[model samples]
Target: AQTVTQSQPEMSVQEAETVTLSCTYDTSESDYYLFWYKQPPSRQMILVIRQEAYKQQNATENRFSVNFQKAAKSFSLKISDSQLGDAAMYFCAYRDTYSGGGADGLTFGKGTHLIIQP
Candidate 1:
């Protein structure tokens, strides 16, 4: 089994600035994937970034990036040039690939609410 944790319950950032959200996970399984998903008021889960346990390099998408410390089992998301559109509830998720190709649903963190101010 895997568990995700988001220590910060809420985060605020000024428009055009940068913000980093903290996340950590616990899993005895060596083959797994870590992800950051954003859910806005619209109630859709959007994939922000994903890191594979086997990959030494972190994953990044546009202004979104992750600091992945495999040894520490930490995966943090960094948002640059934050915009109002970025305001959403961010969740950290984990899935074990070893289990029949991850047929089970992902385990998600409680989430961190992000507010962007102009």
Candidate 2:
């Protein structure tokens, strides 16, 4: 079993600013995937970005990016030019590629409450 931790329960950022959410995990598997998901008011789990354990390069999508340190088992999300819509609960998730159970083997952190101020 694996566990993910988000030390900060909440974070705040002014509109159009930048913010980074930290995440760390413990796992015994050598190959896996890391993901950042955003859950808005609608309660939809939107994929923000993903990073492969074997890939040395970080993953980025538009205003969202991840700082993945495989050796340190840390994956943090950075949101640039943050928008009001970006205000939501962010989750750090992990999945083992060889799990063969799909979403069933996914482990997630408690989540960070992101407050976007005007």
Candidate 3:
């Protein structure tokens, strides 16, 4: 069984600054996938970024990027130039490649509540 862990239960960052959320996972399978999702107050699960185990390069999007350490099973999300809209609950998720498929629900961490300071 694979599990995702988010050490920090809550995080705060100043607007226009940057914050990095830490995430770690345990998995026996060499080929898997990691994802970071954002759930705002609206309660919608949005895909922030995803990384494939087989890919050596980390995944990045706009102001969001991942620091993936395959050997250590660590995948962190870095948000640059954060904005007030960025405030939300960030969840780290894991999916086994060999598992069912796309229809299978993702295994998610508790989540990190991001607070934005004015």
Q: Each candidate's root-mean-square deviation in Å?
A: 1.1, 1.3, 1.3
Tell me which residue pairs clash in candidate 3.
none
lDDT string, candidate 3, 7-108, tens digits: 999999999999999999999999988999999989999999999999999999999999999999999999999999999999999988865655456899
How would you encode candidate 2's per-residue C-alpha lDDT over 1-118 as one tens digit per residue? 8999998899999999999999999999888999999999899999889898999999999999999988899999999999998999999999888656555567999999999999
**Predicted candidate 1 versus true structure: per-residue lDDT over 1-118, tens digit per residue:** 6788999999999999999999999999888889999999999999988888999998989999999998899999999999999999999999887566546689999999999999
Query: Hey, what RMSD does candidate 1 come out at?
Result: 1.1
Candidate 1: give the clashing pairs.
none
lDDT of each: 0.93, 0.93, 0.95
User: Which ranges of candidate 1 are over 4 A from the true structure?
Assistant: none
- Model 3, residue 117: distance off in Å is 0.7
Ten contiguous residues with the weakest lDDT in model 3? 96-105
Better of 2 and 3 by TM-score: 3
Our model 3 lands, by Cα RMSD against the true structure, at: 1.3
